[model samples]
Target: MTTLPDHYEIVRERNGYGSADGAVGPVPAAERRRFVAVDDEGVFDRADRRRTLVATGVGMTGPPHLGTVGQFLTAVALQEAGLDVQFVLADLEPYHGGAPLDRVRRLAERYRTFALDLGFDPDRGRLRTQEGAREVMHTAQLLAPYYDPDRWTEDAGDDSGDTDPPPTEWERAVREAYEAGEDDRRSGTAAVARPGPSSEAADIHSAVLHGADFLHPLYAGDYERLVLQFGVDEHHLVGMARRFRDAAAVEGGVAGLYTRMIPGFDGTPKMAKSIPGAGVSLATSADEIRERIAGDPGGDPARSPVFQAMCLASRYDAERLGRLERACEAGDETWDRARSEYAEFVVGLAERWRATEE
Candidate 1:
């Protein structure tokens, strides 16, 4: 599991990003707003708001979980803060996991509606797909050669079978999906067998598309500077794009804004759609969400799953969040009232989302 301390160290020191204290730029207005770190902070700090585009995306492997909801909210917040934004529905990604094309298309439409309902203004920005996006796909091919095969093939053990480091959350999720058995991707399925040498190469190639998801906007959308938002676990993709842009001699500068990874209830490093019952989602029942939040607030207020959900999933302002945090620490009645309100907020949002499908 990737601890917060170690993750912070990698972003701040190893990646040469500005520290959280130094997060000076156009950012979302949430409580405890920290960029964690931003690559090329100066370029981001000075980028023109009108000409800059902030991009974020989610995979269509599953429905809208709280983690995914948080990402959507971040995009809305960025747009409301005055910078143009683009939200990509990565329908093509689940296809790589063997999801049927028709099912992927349905999920992509659902995701688009959800983002609009969550306050992402189509007038100010764009909500696009990774599949059938002609220019973006072309950009991926153009950038493919620069993806650096060494990024993955290196440190891979020789035939002697020396083990590499532990698998990341993504790798673990993929492995578990394949281990369970074949099924449709609505339940988050994977390839039938474990990834072999050739399959591993395919995985690396998919990353080039991931790079294009971020870079294509700068080239095609006519944006001068681009800011990418993702969870801290996805920080490596920033370096991947930087290398590709430099190698390919692509114009335009890029920077990143990252959110903290919310730990899963299943004791996994982070909440994920592939992990059943890992955390609350739009599909979870209202009674269950209320019970879950009230039953266990977790040990630390800052690290508490309940509080984290409230911070990310709910539309609570910074002042209210601060007040609830203080009350939670004191174990007062205010916290109790606030907890019930938070549960209702999530429940109502879930109900509205479910209604869209019906």
Candidate 2:
């Protein structure tokens, strides 16, 4: 909510943005393009001359939750719109994110299965696992020399305007990772669980590496068009595409599609695994999903996780969604009834995902 981008107006209506904000208008007929670091380019329309790739990824540090599924659903919408979509399993960063080795390994393996369950098209889009494809690490290594520690601090603070946060111990470790040749990485022994100051520090290095990992491969391979879909807050990583000197638009300059962060089920800031009762697991029972949704104290219509669920789930059923919206506007018992419908919508999605897995 800090600021809206130009593309936000166009893509927001595709129903993938998943905000409770009333629809401004249906997506207008326009030339297919995306927001680059400092420019917008007509890239998607020129697929005949060169291949187009739309990619989004998540760190495998936790189970796929409602938030995770929401991101995947948005990716699916992009694919449906004829964007070449790819799902990246960012399994590498958790290793440096201060997560335990066993936990990181487990989550990395588990995330792929759940991602498959979430209905990512295996035929159309490939799961670019960082573990399997060392391109993530290899790319990071190639781009590491470009960033000195000072600019590193600046690039890391892109999300926070004006105020640059203090450095944490994890940042020192990330710096060491940069200095230490690829063969000499001592990250495994030094890594610790991300919490408090450690999480903040771990994030800076993770962002640098993740960005390079994403773009370098495409750049090296000479991809004609690359669309990067990531968490809205992580746009700085996408901006790394511009860091390369003298690279023309034809060398696959990256465009960004940042997915909106889904709020927690209990209306806490963001849906996170570390926060208790804040996340609804993809495999949670319908009863459990209802219970979690009901736990939200409905003070603000906008903040209500139920309403957010409706925003996302409505993609599957527009008629029911319209009815729920009308009920909420009317107020009283009808509004209360809409809650159950929202719950039903979420449960139905979970059910479909489960059924498909079975």
lDDT digits (tens) for residues 57-123 of candidate 1: 8877666778888888877777777778888898777766667789878888888888888898999
User: In angstroms, what RMSD does candidate 1 have relative to the true structure?
Assistant: 5.4
> lDDT scores for all predictions?
0.68, 0.54
TM-scores of the models, in the given order?
Answer: 0.82, 0.67
Q: Model 2: per-residue lDDT, tens digit, 1-358?
A: 2112333343333222433222111111221111112122344445362376777877655556676776776666665555567787776576665666676666666666666656667777767676676665676666655644444443444332234444333234333433442223344432212332246556656655655655754757745657677655455555455543122222555665555445555335456554445567657798998887656544444455565555542354455555655665555577676676667777876776565444
Candidate no. 1 TM-score = 0.82
Model 2 steric clash pairs: 98-192
